[model samples]
Target chain A: MTLIMVVDDDLDLAEMLGIVLTGAGYEVDLVNRGDEVMPLFSTQNPDLILLDVMLPGLSGVEVCKLIREKSMVPIVMLSAKDDKQDVVAGLEAGADDYMVKPFDPAELVARMKVRLRRSGGEVNSDLTIGNIVIDQIEHSIIRDGRIIALTRLEFDLLVALAKEPGRVFSREELLSQVWGYRPATDTRLVNVHIQRLRSKVEIDPENPAIILTVRGVGYKAGVPGSFQ
Target chain B: MNSPFKAWRTSLVIRVTGTIVLLSIILIYLAGSALYTQISSGIFDEKLNLSISDAQSTARNAQFQLTFSQYQDKAALKSIFAEILAVPPKTFDNTAREVAIFSFAKTKVRFKFSGASNFLEVTSIPKDFRKKTKISNTTQWGRAKLSYINGRNEPAIVVGHTLKIAGAGNYEFYVLFSLEQQTRTMALILNYLWLTGIALTFLIGIITFFVLRRLISPIRDAARVAEELTAGNLELRMDINGEDEIARLGYSFNEMAVALQQQISRLENLSKLQQRFVADVSHELRTPLTTIRMASQVIYSARDIFEPKVARSAELLVSQIERFESLLRDLLEVSRFDAQAAVLEIGEVDLTALVKETIDYVHPSQDRIILLLAPITPVIVDIDPRRIKRILRNLISNAMDHRDGKNIEVQIKESENEVSIGVRDYGLGFTYTDKKLLFERFWRADTSRARSTGGTGLGLSIALEDAKLHQGEIDVWGERGRGAHFVLTIPKFAGGSIRSRPISAQPE
Candidate 1:
């Protein structure tokens, strides 16, 4: 059984979240304070973390950074304010996804499921995009005969671009395909994640070549075997 | 010329100095001319009196000499006349003295002897002056130009007297005194007056300019400080000096600035506090709302195990909670607007695609109700897409509610600087009076009708705020039973203002 850790300062909300996720056939570990997340997280070894932005003792953004320093676990932040600074701050701190308060619980569960799903399947095929090889069987990328670690979402995004080498994916399309979001939702999610992904994979993130951007349109994969 | 005119209009110091200089010029010219006229006329009178007296004494000497002479021949009288005509001529340094003897016209003896000394032209005396001299008994004098036979001219005073001779009868004796000395003196005086007048007028101009500039400098400083303050530099102030009228102005101006700065800072603090309160309220309320939403969903999922009425109650609870959550969101947005704390997240977006998406989101059914009239090409604009989407959603949903099964129209238009989105509905129309209060928070056209529509009562108000955040505007037009139209106009670029609206709210 897959285990998910829910961290929030509000006890009732955390309890309700625990109830909802347990009903969805996932074992749940609930923590109420941001500072207490790491101890429980290390022992429980949950597959995903549901963190709240505003918490006692430590902020969700700080906790997210702390978690990112140690592990690559998927983190989806729950923010009370839909303000851009708050959401971007969480994302910049290495959160995989975020949901504003008063979000639909069914939608929350659906996003959680997407975040926890593994990209590699029985049909494992090696893919190449801009001189970087995506090894589906190993769930890692090989660049210049060296392995590069990537998050599950980043791996899925790379695979989506490599699978269809010629097609351009709009931000909205990428949101729906990779983040499991509804059509025409916030596109900042795609923009921030793309920046984060480039910082890790590209030689110079300022001028990107692996994920080439089509101006005023969308993003597309660079030509295969074009390393330099 | 244009630059001086512009300076005259713009600079107070230049204007005042120019006016003073002009007035001084006129006054100095009048006074200088008056002084020059008085001095010149006095010199001429003094010279005329001396010439008359000197000519009178010379005429008496000649009369005595002719009377006492023992000569009986015309040759001896000719020698006497020759001696008297040998007076010296005038040079640039010396006043000229010339003598001429003329025979009277009615004399019995006809000795036609007329001669002048120092090569003086006998015709130098005007005929009018000669006639006056002949008519008078005593020595008569008038002003004349003494012309020399050598072609030299000098201003002179001529005096004439009648003389009796033994053989030569009724000879007219004349003495011409040159006025070159007097003219030179007058010219010297005139030069002095000119130099003095010009020096005085220039001094007055310089003094007036400096004085006025010194007096107005404080005021100029005050204007500069005021401009700085208006440009949001709150710390600027005028420099105050001693207690005078201008210094008093400085004091008062500085006092006003202090008060203004204090007031502005106080308001800023109050707005900050209000923003903090709004944020706190949002955070506090959202936590509870999240809890309630999850609990309601849990109960809603288990509604099938309960009684039918409880199940229905659970359904209503879930839906109303959703409504409450939306109301909370709108209230927070309104509060943000009230505190002037709303920020724009600008991005390039396809306006046509956004509108189509909003229409689909609002009305998912295939009723063919919304008719979109737009350019076939995509219309891209820089805007805060979330706010724009909210505004469009409010307008479209409001239309859906009041459309009354009539066809709705959504039109997009673009100009050089602005873009307009117009949503029109032909349904149960509102009165003209309702348009005035349509955007007011919690204001409804018909309370009973609006209550049934399940609107949050803050939709239009928040929509107006959202439009304002983008520096845009919303216009509404409605008439009784004739449907309503709403139009939103915004700039195509961030930080730009709408110059012309592409779509008007008025129906054709």
Candidate 2:
């Protein structure tokens, strides 16, 4: 059984979310205040977090950052604002995904499933991209005797590019392959995630080598021995 | 193409100054000619009087000398006549005065002996004047030509008189006075007059130009300031110097600017207030609406446990709440558009994929009401996905609503800078005239027809605004009983303008 912690200031919404998660065959832990999330999160050690943006003591974004500092657990934010700033802010704070309010409950479950999906690579799996070694089992990247930390999404993005070094992938293809999103949608998800991934993996985020952009088309993996 | 005349026509200063200069030129010329003629004629009359009296006195003296000579012998008479014709020594002074005489023989009148002092040519007298003077005993004067033996001629006045001598034959005596001195004096006077006229015209022109410019400068400034104000610079004002008519105009213009600024600021404040109210209302309403919607959904999950009536009521409640939520969303969008502050978050995406997504979202079931003609290659572009999605959702939902259980077509096409998505439906089409009013907010069709399609009435209007924000447009074609078609064309990039629509609203 998987444990999911739900954080919200609104009691009824929090309870409703608890009921929905319980019906989906998951153990639910509900916290009303944002301040109460951290203490309970460490003790309960839930598999996932469903946090709301607006909270009484701490914001959902701040809570996401606090959680990201310690753990790589999947964090899905629930914000009433569909505004770009709010969504992007949550994503930048290391929240894996977000859903706007008044969203269908089933869609929320589907998004959570995408976030909680396990990477299918075996422990002995080794991938190489642009002179950087990616150890799938250890979930770490090594470049010239230096180890780097990458979130699950970023790691998956790198692997997706490294797995098929020759094939060029558009944002739509990456969205479907990495984020499990259908092709019939906006590709900003791929854009923001790719940026986050590059900032972690690339030595210089300004000029990326692992993922090279092809003008008027899409992006492709750089040739082997390309990273400097 | 630009002639001086044409330039003058267009320029206010040149037109006025040119007209004044032309009038002054004509006036000065006429006045100058009249003054010149008056002075010249007066000087000529004085010289003519002096010449006439002097000629008469010389002729009388000659007659007296001749009578005394007649008493002597023929040789003495000839000697006296010769002495009378002998010219005095030539002087350097240019008196130009000379005397001439012609002696008539008693029986030989055909051969006239004409002699002149200083060898002045006697034939210089006009033939007409000589004939008249010979026939008539009166002393006559006429303008004459003075011919010297050196072949030079000068204009002169010749006064001719005939004397009936007692012994000598008939003698015609005349005096020729050169009018050169009088001509010089007249020329000097005319030169002064012309100089004075030119100087006066220049002074008048300068005075008129400055005075007119002074009067029109304020007006010109006011016109310029007013033009700037009309061009949307509301802070500009006319410079008021004194309490004159022009200053009064400046004051009034300033007052108008003040009023205009006040009106614009007031309207802006009012619009800001309205936006605030809408934002606040949306925030306040959504909290409760979310709770209600979720509560309804939660209750709806266990509908099988409840009675059929209650279960059906719960379903209706849930659907209506969803419709109400969409209404709230549309109202908020319309308010944002009205405030002119709706911003576009542009990203590169495929229109074909977007259309497919909208179809799936609107009609998730493979129902008979909808059909799609999608593209193979992705029509990639930079656009605000959320807004375009909203517009497509509105358009497709509209198609489904009025679909009249008939099949629909969603087509996508692209051009270089513009991409067009057209939704066609073979259903209860509107009248040709109503097509124009279709984009108007809250406009409904046929009160008699069934209101089966639930709409907030702001969807089309909002969609139109979304297209306009992208510098795009929507064209519609419809007719009664025929299918309705709507085409939306937008540029490929943010801040780009639509050049050519890939698909037109007209049926092909």
Query: Best-fitting candidate, measured by lDDT?
Result: 1
Error of 1 at B256 (Å): 3.3
What local lDDT score does residue B473 receive in model 1, on the 0 to 100 scale?
98
Runs in model 1 deviating more than 4 A are A120-131, A161-169, A212-228, B1-3, B62-82, B95-109, B112-124, B147-154, B160-174, B181-192, B241-251, B302-307, B365-368, B375-378
Docking class of 2: acceptable
Query: What TM-score fits each model?
Result: 0.90, 0.76
Worst 10 residues of 2 chain B by lDDT: B104-113
lDDT of 2 by residue, B322-347 (tens): 88898888888888888876898877
Clash count for each candidate, listed in order shown: 0, 0
Task: Give lDDT per model, in order.
Answer: 0.89, 0.81
Model 1, range B33-93, lDDT digits (tens) per residue? 9999999999998888888888988998888888998867888888888888867655667
Residue B90 error, candidate 2, Å: 12
